[model samples]
Target chain A: MPYTAEISRTNPGCFIFLVDQSASMSDPIGSGEMVQQRAQVVSDAINRLLTELSVKCAKEEGVRDYFHVAVIGYGHTQVGSAFTGGLAGRDLVPLSEIANNPARLESRTKKVPDGAGGLVETTVQFPVWMDPVTNGGTPMTRALGYADSLVARWVDEHPGGFPPIVLNLTDGESTDGDPTSAAIGLASHATADGAVLLFNLHVSGASGTPVTFPDGEGDLPDTYSRLLFHMSSVLPSHMRSYAASQGHRVSDATRGFVYNADITSIIEFLDIGTRATELR
Target chain B: MGAHSTHLDVQWFLVPKTGSSSEECEDAIDVLLSPETSSLFAAVSDGASESLLAGAWARQLVHGAVALMSAADEESVVGQDGLSRFVVEDLLARTVDQWDGYLAKYEAERIARGRPITWYEQPGLDKGAFATLMAVHMREAPADPENPKAVRRWIWRAFALGDSCLFHLRDGRLLTSFPITDGHGFGITPQLLGSRNRNASLIADRVSTATGELRTEDELLLATDALAAWLLSHPEVDSGGAGRQLGRLADLDQELFAEWVQNERDKSRMRNDDVALVRMRVKTEG
Candidate 1:
């Protein structure tokens, strides 16, 4: 019952995404058949997540403001808002604004099943809010600190609402310092519903089977992943249940950490928790 | 068909979800009165909240159900007990066809006004619209054709898909509850009628039907899932107290009903969702 608070326009939830834009992010990931830059993968993930959230909260009039979101990019010894276009320097913009003021819409071709035994090509409109930018070094600690301020303010304002969720996408190399304490400080913020959730997505150059929502860090590839795993918050019960339903092996101790794989599915987990149980 | 003196009192109320304006109510109700044929039709539909243009779809479905029930021939298969399934399924199929045309026109109008469908709306539109449906048809049996003054009885038939329910009460005691019998039976995913579904057999397999006789002073209640779930979950319902309470509620206006629903939600007794109810009373002499 802790995370069961009803999310409405009056008591909206919050999401703060921390993206790592260090020079190391330019390195290519994955093997021969499928190769992509870490920065590009992270940018694509963010755009897709935004699209999923918009679709989930869409109504006849437009998107509803059930959540406020902020995207922070860390690099070159500074951390600041990553949103471009009309929302360039803004933080914690309402979901409706985010849906309506995308930087631009790109037409992308996709292959979908045609209800027959074959597939057909179709064009889809993809909205972009941020572009890939790699700078000097990863100031992950500062990024977490920035999200800490947002989460703290959100909890103070909406004390009775579901706690804010902070997702950090990084390459596990913190140029400033170990971000453990910052991550802990960010996750410590709480509303009446529960403590803030801090999840981590580690985009590493090391090649290994992608591990997602692992219960323990013993199987992690290196010390960097283990450190980030320990910094990540345990998956809330509701999120764990959703992950289980999606065919992922989950347990009470499972932490929200994904390494070298698509993290866009996390958007679905977020929507499931904030879903309006009753039609309004 | 001959004109007959039969009286039926009907009332309906609806409330949107918490934090939503009344204009956003997704549940729809319709009452069809055919005085010449001595028949009365009522229907209620709850649109899927996750689907696009659900409220419009729900409105269309309820109106379509009543129109089909009213226009069917008395000697047709629709009038038979086991064969009504075909009629109801056909009605849904036709509604699906109409929905296709409606969607085309809606999209065209939006584009003509320079506000075409957004990227966020495209995925949901591909899935089409969805809703739950429940309908009732009541007709007065011909008074002894030879003795026009003889008292007449009414035969009522109901068809339901998903969680919407029909309740019958006699002498202020609950006599019957259709489709869903208990609160535990309700679930997040009820059988929904999709706008693209054209398989009549599939629809028929999911539809439930019930028939009964209505005498003077009998009361029938048709409610969407939220209120229906509350009625089944209330402790007093099994003892007939809930039926009496509902009968009293039938006389109140929409504003009062909305207040009552809000009070229930405040007390955490009812789930916060769109609620709708239609109450019908039988009168032998009026």
Candidate 2:
């Protein structure tokens, strides 16, 4: 027989979350919630996402064989050990460990209706991966660069594997330098046979239209949206399904933010990223 | 009122071009070794290279089917009859079920990993993971207390669902050759494939020609796609070659078998197809 190779068993894919924790993130939106408060909502969403993932992985042999998750945050130039305050420097960590830590700063709690006339209460954790320090300028460029390197390293280890996904949540423009170059650099990484996909969640306080891909002159800065769009990889099959099922609901195209007063938008963003990254 | 005991050698090869391997074969064999039937039934599944995961699908078919067969009552003639059909029907159903379950879990895992879930889209049924199956049930009949050659044997049957086959040669005379399935021609385009058309039932053939007398010179060759291509390349081979070359190649050198396959593949007679062959020689009369 000619050389026959073992095909890889079908695997789901991996997802990494990159959150922004700059001091400017503390700025309050137009009579709504501040960036600091929104961080808790996103964290709650991450916790919910983890719960859903664990349930799904337990039932699937291939899913367990193929999937992994990590979270990274950027702010005050510190990385790693979200709850412990020990800086590991621009790295991602699993969710369960973060949930167990007591030293992590707590974001505000909110109780929103579950659509059944019942209120569901939740606590938001600050900086799941990297925390923000108020001392310096916004390093959106460096953050993008770090995220790019992270995804590249992930794909190199998983050849013939599903591509990795990066979901970067940001509030402001790059103050340290131009972010366009870093965005392009991030777009260049891919597996031997596949590619990495990145999504940008631009959180703004102004009333505007939500530009997911960003062209010229919409709600948020079109240039930033375009840059992020350029850095993003094509939507995979799974990611498309997820987006179709939940993206619209979470990230209202009409609203310029990923979430509203409640903190549910973070879950929606995750839904979009999760579903979009599943493309084969 | 009752019967017991079972023994048989089962073998298979993965279609090379299709990217199936002997490792998968070994996995199928492990499943086949279960204590499910008194007359062990062996199978080989060849994946269609034109489809993705066909090889893995083929291996899954054999292993899953064998696991199903082990639970069948080997001594009950009527029960075996129903089981023969159930093995195919139930096995296919189980495989599909397993696949769906895997997909669901895979999707969830993606979410947990903070990734999305994507399902592969094939134009038609044959485009997704699909494989051909060939299987046989063999049992050694009770021996005449003092004479081993007098031992009666029963070949419950050799069954197929889709293209794989089982063949037997009695003193160089071709007795049987099962043919591959010609599933819906929708495979011609990328837009035609769907889950409904992946596998098709080819033919069900049981050979009982050599039951009465046993000869050590008899030979049986069970094969999937690739090996079939080689046998077809010989001077006088065709769709009927499985039944034609049975006993004729018994005494032929094993090297010739390998060479025939190689030459045919090189000549494109086999088209670099995945080939899996199982050659068996009756060592003793019983």
Candidate 3:
């Protein structure tokens, strides 16, 4: 019942995204035959997160401000707001504003099944809120601390609402120090509903296979992946139930951590209302 | 199957989620009285809040179900001996086509108002709307000749999908709970009817039907998911009666109903979702 707070305009939820902008992120990561820059992967995830949230609460008037969001990036010696365009320098912007003030909208192509044996190419308008930036050291400790500030203030403003969820997109490397304690500090912030939730998405360079929401770190292959996994919050009951129903083999110990896999699936963890069983 | 029967009292109560406005409420209900057939037909649908135009789809679904059932030349559209699977599936297949017409007009009106659809909303619209439906049809059974004075019965049939429930009550006790019997069954993303779905067999497999007999002393309650869950889990009902709260359900007007719903939500007795309730009691007086 802890995360079962009614998220609405009167009592909204909050999201704080922590992006690792270390120089190593510019390096390409190859999984099978496909290659993608870690920075580009994280950037795409953030933009999709915004889109998923906006579409969830959208109505006839427009996207409802059922949530407040803040994106913070850490690189070199700085940790600050990652928003671009009109929303630059701003922290904790409402969802409606985020929906209206994206940096730009880019047309992207994707392949879809055409009800035949083959796939067809289709174009979709993709909104961008941040560009890939690979600057200096991965100050992940500082990044967690930065999210702590936003989460602390948000819980103060909406004490009775659902707790803030901090999603950290990183390569599981820390330049400042081990980020375990800093992650704990960030998750300590609490509202009447529950404590802050810190979910980690590790974009590893060395990957045999992409792991999603693993309950244990046994198959993680490296220490950095294990460290980030240890710092993540367990999946809430509602999200866990959804995962189990989807045949994901989830349990009470399942954390909101994804290793090398697309973390955008976590956006579906949000409990807005009854959604379609299948997208089609 | 008909001997000029009618529902004596028909009342419906609705309230949006605690923080939402009236327009934001997505649950829909419609009751049609067909004098020609001496039948009472009703339908209630709970729209998935995450889908665009869900409320409109729910409205269209309920309205379509009742209209189609009543207009059918078949003696009984859906009953114990009725082909409920065919009737319900065909109704869904047709409603989706009607939704296309609704969308066309809606789009034109938006353009006329100087505001057009946005990119983000298009995915949800294209995916089509989804909602849970509970539809009922009732008629007086022609005086069971062998048991002529068998409490002057009425036969009712209901088609259901998702967590919405139809409760049959007599002597202030529940006799039946359809589709979902417990509170834990809610919030499970029950199989929803999509706006573009035309697969008859797919619809038939997901739909459920129940038939019951109503006496002069019997009453019925049709409720959407949230309220239905609360009723199933309510300790008051477990204490041997639904008398205090449910007995007076038909007596409540919109204002009183709203107050009761708000109180339940404040006490954390019910989930904070849009609620719709329809009450039907037999007319005892000749």
Candidate 4:
């Protein structure tokens, strides 16, 4: 019954993203063609996730505040809000404010099918809320702790609403200390619907194949991914079915962790709106 | 083709999502019944909540379907076997063709209201508003045209493209359900009719058509996804199920229907979505 609460404008859900801004994030992320700095990758991931969420909840009037969101950056000495532009210094803001207050919109071009078996070039406005910043050490422990405070406050405020979802985007390098206890503490926050959900995304320069939402850490090549995986919560059933529908192999044991792969699809898993269920 | 003594009592109940207003409800219904005639045209559409102008498009679909059905040949009402592909294909094509004009008027209204299209709403608008449609054309006819002693019966031809369903009941027990078989069959991504879709063949392929006859006291219910899913999930058992609820709920007014839907939503027995239901029963006057 937990995680079954209706996410609506009146009883909104929460999303707290923890982004790693450590010096190690300055290094390149992937092995193949599309390589980017870990900081940029995580920043883009967060932005893309936000964009998708906004679009998913958009209506004729405007984007409804079905979720309140926060972006926290952790590096060097301090862990704080990462939003830029009009929303700078804000912790948890309504989604409509985030949608309207992006730092700037960049014109990006992409190829699309032209309906005649050919491709057409189109320019789209990409909104950016945070820029890549790489500083000193990876203080992931503090990042999770930061999210814990926000989740605790959110659950207290909306005890009958859907529990907050905390997603940690890191490089698996925690300089301050072991972040396991902090991760556990963050995931323990609860609302009347269910306990807070903690999902992890590891974007690192480490040499390995990227895995997403694995049922176990058995195939992980190193300790970093294994640690991140173990810290993650089991995929909620509503999201599990959606992810499975999207061609991802998942089961009851699937954890909400991704290693060097796109977790933006997870945004699609959130049920902010409805159509009908099409035949499988 | 002539007016008959047979009469059908029709009623509809509508409820928006728990926190939303009636104006914000995406479900739509349009019915056309001429005075002193037994023939009726009805359409119900459930708009995709994620799409822009979905409610308007849903309203447009129902109105258009009923209007078009009014002009179509009465004898073309399909039987238990095959459906006229042209009729369904034409219905969708005509609706899609008119969407551009609707969009133009909507744009003007939005600009006048100072809420011009924003970046986030662009994608959903470009993809077009999508909704599930179920429509029916019903009329009274002789039970057996060749048999002089046969009584009259009501015949209905219906087409469904998504989770919105049609139910036939006899003596308060469900005899059949269309488009969606059971409650578990409903999901978030129902087959949608896009406002900009022009593929007649594709639309016809996905559409499911059913024809049935109702006796003097039999009932027919056409409902949007939320109520339809809940109704279909509860099987027609001899002791309880849809039978008990049907008898009690058939006469509920707007306020009571809203309360019933909210009660079910509170208990988590039904998903929190907008609900629309059309209830009809056949009657004969002496």
Candidate with top DockQ is 4
Q: What CAPRI grade goes to candidate 1?
A: medium
A best-first ranking of the candidates according to their lDDT comes to 1, 4, 3, 2
- By DockQ, highest first, what's the ranking? 4, 1, 3, 2
User: Interface root mean square deviation of every model, in Å?
Assistant: 1.5, 12.2, 4.2, 3.9
Q: Write the residue-wise lDDT of candidate 3 on A156-229 in tens digits.
A: 88998788888887774888898999998988999888888888877766544667778998878778789888
Q: Candidate 3 or 4, higher DockQ? A: 4
lDDT of 2 by residue, A2-97 (tens): 101112224335677766777766655443444344454455566556544543332112222234566666677653223234434425444233
List the lowest-lDDT window of 10 residues for candidate 4 chain A: A271-280
Q: What order do you get sorting by TM-score, best first?
A: 1, 4, 3, 2
lDDT string for model 1 (A220-253, tens) is 8778888988998888786787778878898889
Q: Poorest 10 consecutive residues of model 1 chain B by lDDT?
A: B73-82
TM-score of each: 0.91, 0.46, 0.89, 0.91
Instruction: Give Cα distance to truth, residue B80, candidate 1, Å.
Output: 6.7
In model 2, how large is the Cα lDDT of residue A44? 52
Q: Higher DockQ: candidate 2 or 4?
A: 4
Tell me the spans in candidate 3 whose CA falls farther than 4 Å from its real position.
A31-33, A206-227, A241-251, A258-280, B1-7, B79-86, B143-151, B236-240
Model 1 has an lDDT value of 0.82
